[model samples]
Target: MSTVVQDRSSAGPLLAKTAIVTGAARRLGSHIALALARHGANVVIHYHRSASQAAQLARQMTQLGVRAWTIQADLADAAQVEALAARSIEASGGVDILINNASFWPEDTIWDMTAQTLQTCMDVHVMAPVILARALARQQREGHIINILDTRVTDYDHKHISYHLAKRTLHTITRILALELAPRVAINAVAPGLILPPDGYGTEYLARLASTNPMNRYGQPEDVVEAVLFLLRSRFITGQVIYVDGGFHMRHQLYV
Candidate 1:
């Protein structure tokens, strides 16, 4: 029931400030891009295969009165990840904010997991963020890097072993990079739970899960978006993972 008090004056032209959001063509990334634009930040939306969707998002951003561009890159490729960072800088003038939201989520039991599946998950969820962060650091630009982590990091689960391991690495980076980036740039994470479920999971499924939480409802994308904005504006905060889970983590079991 807490109201978000956005600083309208601090809304000073993010005019020239640019942000790169990977996997930004749809889902939560799209919401994050729109939220940043609402605060006046120019955005570079990165996509792997959702070309038309990325284009649509860019157009929507323009309508919000901010500059927006779309770039396509397969994050699984190291060279492509490097190029993604480079292109973001080139297209948007200079990357000021980097939201590492691209990830591979596969449903495979530990027994059924393959080496390729594990490696691919690691490449997208762990390595790409590292490469992108390294490239950004080399630019010597004061920036913010927000890695989107899953709420399950605090609690281990074996359902998606590869996905879980890769995301856990991001949590480690959140702390490590916070120290490495130091007084110049800020690095943090927003660990979301049930904001939007994976493909095939519907509202009824979400409601059932939400009923187990103390809040009794699934979180909305705005919840995480607000968390991101808070981290971005709070100069004193960094190296933290703010969970937008509505207390679901406190429950003993998530009744599927």
Candidate 2:
């Protein structure tokens, strides 16, 4: 099993600010939401098929002494994405932060990859973030948008061609949006590495990959959360991709 690290620190209240976390039901998304709520931000936990998990997360946040709610939306659907932004605005008065953590990663060799698979990855990873950011920017309210990117963007992986391509496109979006949303809303990315194995990956495989990092250990979700908090609180930083990857990218090909 993958190692787990938890932070039990007490955080001051965000004083009723609102944040929307896409795919907040499980894994990294859940961790991010809890971190923001612990600091006093009311979170809107969005999930598509993880309804029960989303509800449970909301309850957990409420127990932390702040408002929390769940919204179900398939982000790949442009309409649903727009509705999500609208609903969040209606409930929270205005969204102060948007975390685009939801993504789809499917493994297929280039020859076996279908157009549908490629399109799906692009839609969720690229199009959704762009659309969501645009909608939020139009609100004319000051806000922050964080895109969750993969560490592989800095070091390409040939196996997951479709997924990598989509993520690369997202990186481009981050740069363009940071310039476009400038002076009002900050746009940045957190590229995590081996924090949690991709869903369905086994423990042995994860352990092997962890050993490849220069730190010789996999990163915890809290590591990424720390980077996120830094970006969110830093009033001066924008258009940067912070890698919370345990120095995994610093080393060249291990076997070459």
Candidate 3:
């Protein structure tokens, strides 16, 4: 297990603001939502099928003395993506932050990857995020947008070809959108590596990968949260990809 750091400070850095975090029903998304709520931000926890989990998380966050609600949408659908933003804005009055964290990671080699799978990757990881960012821009003139990316974007993952392709496209999108939405909304990304084990894997899986990381450790969800907070709190930073991957990216071969 990665280091668990529970923030007990009463800072409330995001006081009176609203944040919409996609895939916030569990895992890293849940941690991100609670972190923001802990800082006094009302959170819109978005989920697709985890209805019960989403509601439970919303209730837990609300108990923290902040407003929290859950919204459901299949990110693979364009119309649903649009409705997600609209509903979130309506529920929270306005969205001050957007975190694109939902994704589908299926294990498949390049030879077995299908066009349909690739399209779903693009729809979920790239298209939906673009839609939400644009919608948030329309709703709030000034805010922060943080995309939860994979550290593999800096390297190759033949086993997850389609997933990697979509994430790499998102990596580029983050930079472009940051420039387009600059001076009003700062767009950035946090690339996590060896943080949590992939779905269907155990802690041992991450522990094995951790040994290969330069830091010789696995990262906690809170580490990613800290990077996000730094980006959101900054006034002059935008269009940057912060790797919370324990120096794994530095060791990856860059194709310059």
Candidate 4:
């Protein structure tokens, strides 16, 4: 990382800082990584299977005048998750921001929910975040941790029961970690709503779902990135969830 200090009085307030964003190869994670890099933070882009995409993203981020590294890790694997944090620390010299943006959005109804599938969801949404947070705490003090969450907590998703339950668990974990890592690290979350369509869905699906929000429109990835940036730049805020959803959480509609 370059030690030369530039006048960060500009929009890039996080100049010279380092951030780790999981599942950053594409989609919303990719947008978040680019936003952080645009704001002058060196990024560690974590991916599970998108090696080529991740490398391309790193190159683009570096082209923005910030350092970027790609790390592949299956969030479901505890060992790989741990190794990701370790490698990020070694590569960046130390981590100043940690964004738990990787998640598994499983589609299983209550009757269809199996032990194996439930365990996998829990491993990614709940267990992996806790492990990464603990590792980041050990690597650096006075940093920020942002968990990427969904707006379904206020509503219900019967079709994705296992995934919904795991995310709720992660929501609680965020608050608990905020208390546990207080004064050393500030932890918070950004709950996104209608930001991106699921794997099989199309733009029409998102357009139909947009009615659930009072805004009557879909949100862009930049909305979530702005929420993440707010949490990262503010030192006094912690354990809060900024819903980037277009008032959908307020309506309590089914997201799945």
Candidate 5:
């Protein structure tokens, strides 16, 4: 099982602000939402088919003494993406933070990857965040945008070619948006690696991969979450990517 971060903090680092965290129904996304709410930020939890989970997580965050609501949208649909951004802005009165943490990871080699799968990857991982960021800029919302990228964005995993391709494109988009939405809104990315093991896997599964990174160990979700908090704390830190990967991203390998 992955390590968990309970919502017990009493600090109010994000008091009176609102955040919209994509894919906040479960797993690491739920942890991030809880952390933001613990810091006094009202959170809008976004999910697609996980309606019950999203609602329950929203209620849990509200128990942290912060406003929390759930929104549903198919991130793979352009129109739904637009509506998500618009509705969130209307409901939150202006979003102070946007965390593009939703993911659609599937294993497909470059040779067997389909155009349709690739397009879905682009829509969910790349364009959805772009649309939300553009909406924020159009609304003149002054806040931070943190894109959740993978440490494998450099094409290390030849198995998940489409996923890596889309994430790599998002890596580039983060920099471009930072330049385009300067001063008023800052943009950055957090690339995480080996933070959680796959389903049905346990600690030994993670420990076996310790040698894959320079630190010789995996990290937890809170490790990635802290890097996010650091970025949010600064107004001058835009267009930067913090790798919370136990230095696994520094390992050099091509299409492994």
Candidate 6:
């Protein structure tokens, strides 16, 4: 058996495909949604509370000549997650792609980590993704599922205990589901590092730590977006994680 896979050229463009991108109102998720649309895939933007922004993004995507719909669903709620999947399927016939990018990163440490906080992290990062994957699998469609993870999973972030734990769990789930889903749905993850500032930070903040990575600069959302497109295009690759974090993931902070 040759280790080399079949030709990837046949995957072709994203036309005739519908992609559901969660938390797509803004941030990295928004960029991923736009890229999918630009590549000719109909897009379904999922936003928890950012209705206005989601609608605005939908308009932009439609301008790109791809069908775009904005759907509101609180991914932390299982019922809402189910509704999102159903709505996405209804909006575009069938879903050919699912991007589980909805997540919230709260600044918390061991001292500040409460049970509620931990559960909330898991709800959005773990449960919602799993639920969404279940729905995607049941559809019996040949598609791609990309879970947005963090490079910190390779190391650890003590300051953000719950987020770190949940994302790492998601990374494990990505690999496991890839095997279980098999030849039908290709599951993969893209772990991004310092691509965008966590909620309250500004560009200056990223610039301050720009040289910390081997790339010597901060990464843009487009970097992660392209990695996602690459994974979606590879017909035979699954259960893999692409680090869009420059070289940060390669060098783990053992001291931390």
TM-score of 4: 0.93
Error of 3 at 30 (Å): 0.2
Model 1 misplaced stretches (Cα beyond 4 Å): 1-10, 13-15, 252-256
- What would the per-residue lDDT of candidate 4 be over residues 1-256, giving only the tens digit for each residue? 4432233457465888999999999999999998888778999999999999999999888777889999999999999988998899998899989899888877899888999999999999998899989988886577999999899977789988988999999899999999999888999999999988887788898898888898899999989998998888897998899998888887844444
- Candidate 2's residue-wise lDDT over 64-111, tens digit each? 777888999887788898898888889888888889999898887777
lDDT of 1: 0.84
lDDT of 5: 0.87
List the candidate 2 regions with Cα displacement exceeding 4 Å: 1-13, 201-203, 253-256
Residue range with the least summed lDDT across 10 consecutive positions in model 4: 2-11
Stretches off by above 4 angstroms in model 4 are 1-12, 252-256
TM-score of the candidate numbered 3?
0.93
lDDT of prediction 6: 0.87
C-alpha positional error of residue 197 in candidate 6 after TM-score superposition, expressed in Å: 1.8
Clashes of each: 0, 1, 0, 0, 0, 0
Tens-place lDDT digits, model 3, residues 1-256: 2122224354544877889999999999999988888777889999999999999988888777788888899999999999999998888789999999999997777899999999999999999999999998886469999999998898889999999999999999999999988778999999999888877898899988886668899989989999988887888999999999988887745322
**TM-score of each model, in listed order:** 0.91, 0.91, 0.93, 0.93, 0.92, 0.92
Clashing pairs in 1: none
List, residue by residue over 138-208, the lDDT tens digit for candidate 5: 87768899999998875367988889999999999999999999989999999998988876789899899
Residue ranges of candidate 6 with Cα displaced over 4 Å: 1-11, 253-256
Least well predicted 10-residue stretch by lDDT in candidate 2? 1-10
lDDT of 1 by residue, 1-256 (tens): 2122133356553445788899999999999988888787889899999999999988877776778889899988999988888888887777888899988888877899999988998899889998888878777878888999998887776889889988998899889999998777889999998899776777778887887567888988899998988887777778998989987666666544
Say which prediction, candidate 2 or candidate 5, comes out ahead on TM-score.
5
